[model samples]
Target: MNQSVFQKAMNEIHSRRLHASAENERRFQEINTVIPELAEINFQMAQTASRILHGEKIDKIRQQNLQAQRYARQLLVTHGYPEDYLDMHYTCPYCQDTGYFQGRYCTCLEKEIASLSVETLNRNTQLQLRSFDQFSLEYYRGLTKSNTKGETVDCYAKMKKTLDYCIQYARNFTAHAPSLLLYGEVGVGKTHLSLSIVTEVLRQGYEVIYDSVGNLTSQIEQEHFNREKSDINTLKLLLDAELLVMDDLGTEFQTSFTDSVIYNLINTRLNRNLPTIISTNLTPGKLEEQYDERIMSRLCAVYQVWELMGEDIRMLKMKERRSSQYL
Candidate 1:
């Protein structure tokens, strides 16, 4: 993980602590309105403790402190308040918002760092601009049937179904949700829909790891092989994320390492029943040919496959812009 990202996480933890402390003080002030002597007793105890810390072992100081606490408790109970109500309310009591427990990083801090680090790494993508509501269905209107080669493949209906399924999938995503295999040609909104799911799943507070197959493989190779210089836990984050979305599956460099890594990752996710979303340009035949029968069988048997077909929406948008310019 990046050092700066870790620093941000630390800052967040400290900020929480500061806020809790301030709120606790405010609560105490509010309580003082009802029990003025309780606040005075607390102030006296603070002064006594300060003097004790400074080596002034005054006789009966400890007894006086205990008596003050007992009186405060009795008053609180009589007023229908919990004895310990004045204590700071921390979100994570394990670390008390300090991000560490017994000199070790707390689980809350680790999870926060992982989330921040992953988002930092994925910030290069244009995912923020792509959302289900923003995806225009107008482009798929004219070419309802037949693909680019004039094949009679009812492209429009398939595209519409794909869009609906993706939107629904995002709305009801769970850890055990069915894995998705989205295959089609370029610019058919596969990436857009996948990213839309990412946004929704994230909004629902689930961890999602979305990366192109090319970048995923490249990062794995760099970190796994070059262990000495690598600090990012790339593979761990991918495998542990609630949902993994690999866009443009077959665009990655073809190598023995890449093939094995992909197979292992997919197979592991399947074994664990973890949901994954894979979008590729390769047809079923091509996918089988490229990754062999094992991967194909797993995908076909376990994944909810969708084949989206439409003209390249990117080109359509470009043409529309040019036409508007001429107008």
Candidate 2:
């Protein structure tokens, strides 16, 4: 498991602890107002508990404490509140939101850590910035025509349609959602929309794995040639993620090993009916030339193909920056 996953779980436990404390205090304040003597009883109970350290028997103090608790419950019942309403409320009562019980990590914490581990193992934090709301279709402005290849050429209308498709895909994503192939030229929002989809999918609580093709291939190559067999293989993570988003698909240093690994990952995911999002700067013809027929067949046939059409937004941003500098 990733160390950051465990850290995230610990942070969640801290938040739950604070929430429980605040809830307890809020309830105490509400009840204390109705029964002023309840505060005195609580103080006396604390003092009585301290007597245990002095070797005093708790029989009498126990009876007094029981009576106070009964009185508190009765008062709560009279005021239309639950009997345990004033007690410390916990989101996870099993561990009291402490993430541990009986000197070990609790089930809830373990589950959270495991979920986060799967996500972190597959995720690229650098891609976290892009989102649906942040994308600007205005950059795609031009004609609405399609080229001779029957592909939508550079146009605002075509890009807007692609944007709508991605937004819908993200909004409706599930564990069993269809796989996606986002193909376009460089700086045409293929990566942007793919990242945005993953972000929305993550927000919906599904564990997603995201990585650029270059990074993914390099990591797999390193692991494949490692002398130590004990090292964890990232290929498993890539194949098993609930939603795998592979960005910059044709940018990796292609080789026999990388080609095989890419095929295995995509083919395996497809066989298992797992969803994957592939963003590439290559057309179907170019992709065929780069990869074999098997990989391209799986991607083109099985995945929901989305071809993005627009001007190079990166160049536009660069020119805008230059203009601003002149100003």
**Number of clashing pairs per prediction, in order:** 0, 0
- Candidate 1 lDDT score at position 314: 98
Q: What is the lDDT of residue 297 in candidate 1?
A: 89
Model 2 lDDT per residue over 270-308, tens place: 999999988988887788888899898888788888777
Which segments of model 2 are wrong by more than 4 Å?
A: 1-116, 119-125, 144-154, 229-231, 324-327
lDDT of 1 by residue, 213-239 (tens): 899889888887784754467887787
TM-scores vs. true structure, each candidate: 0.83, 0.65
Lowest-lDDT window of 10 residues in candidate 2?
144-153
Model 1 weakest lDDT span, ten residues long: 141-150
Candidate 2 displacement at residue 80 in angstroms: 15
Name the candidate that leads on TM-score: 1
